[model samples]
Target: MFSYCTDPDTLSGFSWLSCYLTTGKHMAFYRAFGTVLLLLAITAPTALAFGFCGARAARSQVAPLRWFGKIYIAIVRGVPDIAFFLFFVIALDQAFEWLRHQVKCPDWDEPIRQGNDFVVCQIAKMPLGNAPQWVHETYGFFLAILTFAIVFGAFAANILYGAMNTVPHAQMETAEAYGMNRKQAFWRVMVPQMWVYALPGLSNLWMVLIKATPLLFLLGVEDIVYWARELGGSKTARFSDYPHPDWRMWYFLALLVFYLGFTKVSEVVLDRLMTRLTRGQATMGGEAQRKAAA
Candidate 1:
């Protein structure tokens, strides 16, 4: 917004473009890019934590825990991720509201599921109906995060399970022979050793997670994709100050470049992490590192 921006009809070329890009809506659009990054930053660690727990459950001595873990991993992998993303957001939202309804409205006679509608008490409405706009947005984002974690956690569990198995049986046996308990063996020998094997699968999962960020729009989160579509659509004089032709193609191109750059940076970082993890291990990479050092 400069004085020239006051007369858009006369402004053209780079001047018009500069004024257009500096609009308040465009600022929001730019912030949405940061939201995407925030989602990834939050979801990655949360999903990994879920995966670690699921993987541990799958390997648990208790039969029921193992069965539950196995079922979670299997069912999620069997379904399309988009399907899960759609289903889980609704299901989880309802589950939370239902629990809240029970606690907050104990005397309510109406069933939560009256035919197809998921009815809940006013108190149980997510964001409480009276909450601020930011609260609603935050709740949607939280749901998206949960959905992402649930879906990707299963894949991570599978990867970690295989990695755990790849840890040498001899290593565990030696740990036990040294009077280490099963937990100790797992913590000291198996867990650390499995990282080298798991890194490749986990790295791929990270890339998948990055690409899947676009699905945040489906979850009702104001993610970058949502902003891109909203801002890139053809605007009219009646609706916007900066009306233009269809620009979705260019917006999507920007998203593509952003993701490519993100993935490239992740690859570089993960490669370095893998190199660090492989050191002093008995794997091929570790052996190679040792030889090179020698």
Candidate 2:
């Protein structure tokens, strides 16, 4: 905070507002935007990896693998995304601690689950009780990313699985006729064409993912929404550098603009990507490109 912030009551106009927005807490608030971006950066690729694995498994010749893949897609899709987010974070957290407890406190005889409380031996805590604050925050961020990956992975798998099916069987047969092995045919022939089909669904999923970033608050991460509430709430002289009336509506309006601008930019990028992927493919997009060039 500025020197003026030392006496918020005495300051007015831009001086007061500047001091208020630069408080230590407000700095944290500003950093929360980065938290959102970091989550997306880490989660998107992890989610894509998960989806790719699930899609490949679903198409595997092994019956067990196929069944497992199908079940994963079904269970995740059947539940509401928000419900899954709430449920999985808890389940996964407990699961990690439970496994740790088994390893770390095998000799302990007390029940881990008693009433509403879950007690694990001190060493079994995910970060251990003595772990630093940064460790705790990092662990929580990891779980949030995993939860997002699991949920969005299912959606991506469905899109990719359908895309795989949409690839012409004749193309596969032609690859075989040319003496290409199944794996070679898949990598060289099927994968390329599948993108032409997958991009639209993947684009929609990307938009949904952007919209869902606010759920980071539910995961207990101090995301942008969390900061918006903390900084925008009415502050009293007793609790703030520059006390002000509630301005949460204005804060949320800014968020609205941020998302709308981001999504529009994403649309433009995805459109360009679609055009590039569709080029020279036997699709309507390619046809249009050829006619335009003519």
Candidate 3:
């Protein structure tokens, strides 16, 4: 990255370190941190939306819808995350390609599964083989996002379903007494109040989501952990410009600090949010806030 980076052999101490850190690979390593943050930003809301739908479905008057929601929560929450991540990404990718193959390769007689291989026409590839590197990366990242959402959403649904029930039945009755319909009472009364109950669980889920970002590596997204291992692996002068001993421990220590700091910040923010949500409400948290104020 620097003009002096032309000669890594002569550079030493801080000078060598600066150039090494500013190399193209290092830039990518830096961007990997953003990738992790971006995953969290997008996945959190998407999962929440999925959870909301699932929670609502679980509580639906229609038995089929309620059953579907309960089954979704049960199955997803029951699965181990690593197993699900491994299975789901391949299954979802193949499902997409299979659907596309049916449309794009209708004339072909070959079955998609040839013992162990999933073969589809070139055109049916998720990101066509000829597509840019970014397209492939984006597609993988999208799969990662979807996988994260599905897994986390089920847990969120369970938390939300419980939270919804925790909201007093009398509150719903009061809304009905005021001539509001069931839907209106749910939206205007129960949903608004459930957040206070859900926040603690959601807060923990957010932290878990943060920790789970490393699983992106398994999905083939070049996440921070991937870059850390790549960059920190011992590089010899024979093969590369920046030759260094194995620094993975140091790299991982940096990651440890980053996650710790990120979670700490999340905790502070969630705590303040909890306090705000509880103020003037009827829960124990609200009561405590009131007592403290008095």
Query: What C-alpha lDDT, on a 0 to 100 scale, does residue 196 get in candidate 2?
Result: 85
Tens-digit lDDT track of model 3 for 1-294: 889889899999999999989999889999999999999999999999999999999999999999999998898755588999998899899899999999988999988789978889999999898999989989999999999998999989999999999999899899999999988998899988899999999999999999999999999999899999999999998989888899999999999999999999999999999888999998888899899999
* Model 2 lDDT at residue 286: 92
Clash tally, candidates in order: 0, 0, 0
- The numbered model that scores best in lDDT is 3
**TM of each candidate vs. truth:** 0.95, 0.95, 0.95
Candidates 1 and 3, the one with greater lDDT: 3
Model 2 TM-score relative to the real fold: 0.95
Compared with the true structure, what per-residue lDDT tens digits does model 2 show for residues 1-294?
556567767888888779877888879887888888888889888888899889999999999999989987787755678999999899999999999999989999999999999999999999888889999999999999999999999888988999999998899999999999999999999997898899999999899999999999999988889889988899887876577899999989988998999899999999999989988988888999999999
lDDT of 2 at 129: 86
Against the hidden true structure, what lDDT does model 1 obtain?
A: 0.90
Clash pairs of candidate 3?
Answer: none
For model 2, the stretches where C-alpha displacement exceeds 4 angstroms are: 1-7
Candidates 2 and 3 compared: the better one by lDDT is 3
For candidate 3, the 10 contiguous residues with the lowest summed lDDT are 72-81
